[model samples]
Target chain A: MDRRDFLRLGSAAFTTATFFPQLSFAGTLPHGWLNGFKDNQGRYGVAYIDQKLQAEVLFHTPLRLHGIYKHPTRDLIVAPARRPDTELYVFDVTTKSIKVITADEGRHFYGHGQFNQDGTLYFTTENAYDEERGMVGVYDVTQGFKRIAEWSSGGIGPHQMRLYKNRLIIANGGILTHPDTGRATLNMDDMAPNLTYIDITTGQITQQFSLSEDLQHLSIRHIDVDDNGIVYMGLQDQVKNRRDLPLVWKTNGDTLDMMDEPVEGWEIFNGYIGSVSTNTHGLCVASPRGGCAHIWDQTGTTYIKQKDVCGVSKNADGSFILTSGEGIVRDLDGQNQRHALHFDNHCQAV
Target chain B: MKRFFLFSFLLLSPIAVQAAPSMQEMSLKVTEEFILPAYDDFAKQAHAQSELWGETCDAEKLKPAFQKTSDAWAKVQHINFGPITSLLRRDRLYHWPERRNSISKSINKSLADKDPASLDLDKFASTSVALQGLPALERLLYSDGLLDGDFACKLGHTIALNIEKIATGTDKDWQEALVNIKEGIAHPIYFESMDEVAIRFFTEMLAGFQMITDQKIALPLSSSLKKANGKRAEGWRSNRSTRYIQQNSLALMAMAKPFMSFMPDDVEKQVVAQFTVFARAANALPLSIKDGVKDEEGRAKIKKFLDETRTTRNLLVQTFTKHLGLTVGFNSLDGD
Candidate 1:
């Protein structure tokens, strides 16, 4: 299809009316299917989470809004200040106003922004978008908007971040290369790419491992590490082969050694891994309809595909609040697949 | 030197601060969807379906038999990442409309067990199954999904299939299967290809199988494919596209030795076909060809075996097929 036609069709703005029937596809699941929420066939120009899906005009932005975190100390949702900066946005969920913090840092944003156990420190990654910019970073979430204890994206597209006590696992999905253009999406093939680790306090390069074979396409987008220290990242493999990219990798905490690697084209996508998080012992990653959600365990590696699912987050009651381009959730896991919280625009989550 | 140091320091600072080291083995979020008891379960079942074709006296029996096989293929789609798979993987397992899975399985089994010298009526009937469904790729592009491609998948298939007809046909018809395979193997050489059906479907399908097992990564062979390509320089491979090209090459290689070893006629011509398939697969490797590389070493070993088959015949075929089996790797039998 031509770009004009695609933009015309894809930019229709996600809507509940457009998606209500989609949720019925996986009707057996208590939480609605994620595929039901995605544009499914959209060309992926920009993505947004309409609070209208859950509420009316709560907060809105046009940064293609990747990662947004709920503030711990106050009523705020902290998303990347923008796609290209450490610019963190502190938006009030209650008041419906937003502040772009870290605006001074001109780095490109990926997603998955969060605070340390103390809630005082914030961590996230930004792509250099190639060497034109520096990669991702880890900063402190302060009373005044600021990015502290920052870092580079390593290669070109350093994406999300995970904080583990003295250590941090960066989900650096190299997303710079464009498939249609047939160029280095991340312009990282000239350099090495991998999960780079450093001791938070010492700021030393503890160790790094590269998805050496496929170059920069092994974008480590989102991450979740268990108590045992095994790390996982939602991968968007660069190439479009059944055998490469759009994968997930795992590593042991203590050794920082890789326990799992992405199967080239092993999953349903060749796109970005949006948001990945864990509740209790369970973990999930969004393939952006690269498609669906993979919920797995740390110890035995038990996994379940909440097929066509996304926005997997833990609710206050130990349940999940899954947001889709369509609005749906598996509030209690009973499998009704009901459309919850109606909306008129694209619906992601806070 | 001072200026370089300053540049490097500024460059390294954020990477040092913002980036957290990644774990070498990340437990993937979606691998759970792909856990299945087998990777080729549908293929296996399809093989079974192929065997049962026309065995019964009743047509009712025949339809159900085909339906059962078709059902398995349907399940495979639900498991596969995307709605459509490339013709190559599709070829590995046949699919028919009415009773595809079963009928294809019947053909494969009969062929696998058939002896040319003792061939019978049953063998011909079972092995006669054809590819049925939404027309092959060539038709899709020119007819439906595409507008501007030099050729689509079916055009390629038709060329190969016609070549086979010419080589193997009776004195008047002039049709043959081996000839078809050879030309098909060489087609890419003449054409500078553009796009291919992406592999997201493969990953998603594999992930679906993995889900049943709920494992970290979907397929065991993933590690091997990654490891094989890992050591090479990124260069042109930095582009995300090369994955499909690499897989296409590997799939062709798997067919190379079998085509050669199974050669029925002039040793020279048969060896030529075998070499062609092997070379095509190798040339398609995504990395720019390099000397003194490990890939070169492996290719050399396979090529040597292919060449040896010219004189040694059966020994080379066994050796090559064994190699193909090893290279493709294994998945759980359940499609997991």
Candidate 2:
């Protein structure tokens, strides 16, 4: 009937299902809980569920969200709009209130952002659509999320960037699609999608690596970092001639190694991968299109299939918690939890 | 306080009940009118095709039945989520948008080895799905390699029979599923509420448009007309890309009809007009969508049609649903 009543209903619905087996782990649990959107009835907003699976808070958004970023030093969460969207919502988890912000003129969110250390600055990948460029918007978080500067993401259609120390590792999905044409990749044959490492302070591209000539069609879209600081990237292959191309790659600052999977195993992915995350064991990648999630060990080898799952994030001890669009959540061992909500493609531990 | 709350709920109950019947009627009519009948037609045509294949292994005899079955499939392919998804029946029916010619490769290997298992209808169930669907049948019937008395024709006959079996079985499944859905709606579990059922229907319809827009057209069109690639079109192997999309638009238009009463009258007209424009442009395209992509005028026409279909999809997804007082919370097509 009202905010308190709806919250009570949500909490009772979520926490009453306590019959699930205890999810065993080997190390200290993550400090904070999981945060993602609780989408239902075509209405969506941020949702926070604690370690005990207690529903903490829920807030509504007028537009769809992409990834969630926790403030470096506060109880705030920042979620950007899905690409071609011009809005962003900053939710203060403590107060359960949100502040909406608009991207500057001629720019729109590429759906991901991360705060620099100490939460002083926020950087997001954006489309300089009119300029045919991929630019990163730098916000002075202390100055009320001010747009202080902009930098090239080092390629076109940049999506999913992360902070590695002081540098930014960006997966510049090379396919150029205009918001006007609506998600159609303007350049497939001649388009170049690359992974770039940039110096965040100066907005300079420190290093960039393009896929080999034969693998140019693989748009490196999502990325995650292993405990060892190696960046593992997942690709959505755009070429129709080949579906067996490797969909997972790992990088150590300079070079990229295409991880191998059995031909049949790769076929299960159907050439589209949605998200990637890393844990102590290895990297976890999701293919929502293929309805499969895969794991590759730290060596960047040894592929394993966990069928019919997606929306993966790491637990404190480095095991994976997976969610599905069907509203089921479970860990690697399959201790299941259910709620009346659709889990979007991204989830993370704050 | 409790007494007052109870009184208010009682006062509002009739109004809530009054809103549900129209939603129920819409869902029921769609299942009864469009979805069930299309799957039924698919089953009947597939059975006829199998019978023709059995009567004569001749491709000429089999071709007409094959096309009829394919057209039937296109009409109902929008049901990609429910009963047909069971046992990979949908993929087994037509593995278009195939990977690296796997269908041809699997078929070729089976034929080359003269795999006795290929002739066994039951054994074909466990075979790679690539060899089991309409695509395989189209290949065996229309490709030049198959002779009337050849082993490949025997395999083709077995596949045809298998497709018939799946189609018939799927139709039965749909009937049973509809029964369960109706029961669930009345009881509110298979779907949480009547609103959910309506939302699910709209979402599926939206998903159908997404498949046409993303996989069928945009994937091939790439960024521009100059860079078009026809190989990405669905049903490229059969050269039925445009035909397939035409059937899809027709089916989608039919689906929108029952929901028209729920929408503003002009919205209905606008939605239908858009579909009609796209369908005309789609049907008028040259022999194959791939070939169409190679010609400047043809590409322009195809692009215009795709843009129109996208607009129609947006209306159904955003405006139509909102007007119907439904919400689609999320679309898988809206990726990160």
Residue B191, candidate 1: C-alpha displacement in angstroms = 28
- At residue A345, give the lDDT of candidate 1: 13
- Which candidate's DockQ is highest? 2
CA lDDT, every model vs. true structure = 0.37, 0.71
Which parts of model 2 are misplaced by more than 4 Å? A1-65, A68-109, A113-158, A163-181, A185-350, B1-23, B146-149, B185-197, B261-270, B284-287, B330-333
- Output the TM-score of candidate 1: 0.42
lDDT of 1 by residue, A1-350 (tens): 34464344334433101111011112121221111111223211122222222221223233334445555555545656334334455654344445555434334455456566766766666544324443435565565455555665454455556667777656555444322111223232232346767566665656666765433445565666666666766655333323333366577544333324333234434344555666666666654444355555455443333333445665444444555433344443543232322211112233
TM-score of each: 0.42, 0.63
lDDT of 2 by residue, A78-187 (tens): 88887788887776655545677899998889879989988999999999887889999999888889899999899999999988888898999986766756776656
Expressed as tens digits, the lDDT of each residue in B1-336 for candidate 1 is: 232223223323432222211111111111112212123443454444444431332333434433443344334333332222332233223321111233334433433443453233223223332322212211222233321222222222232232222212211111121132223322221111110111222233333322211110111111122222232321112221223223322332332323333334454365566546544543444333222123545444423422332233233333322321211111111100
Please give the RMSD of candidate 1 to the true structure.
22.6
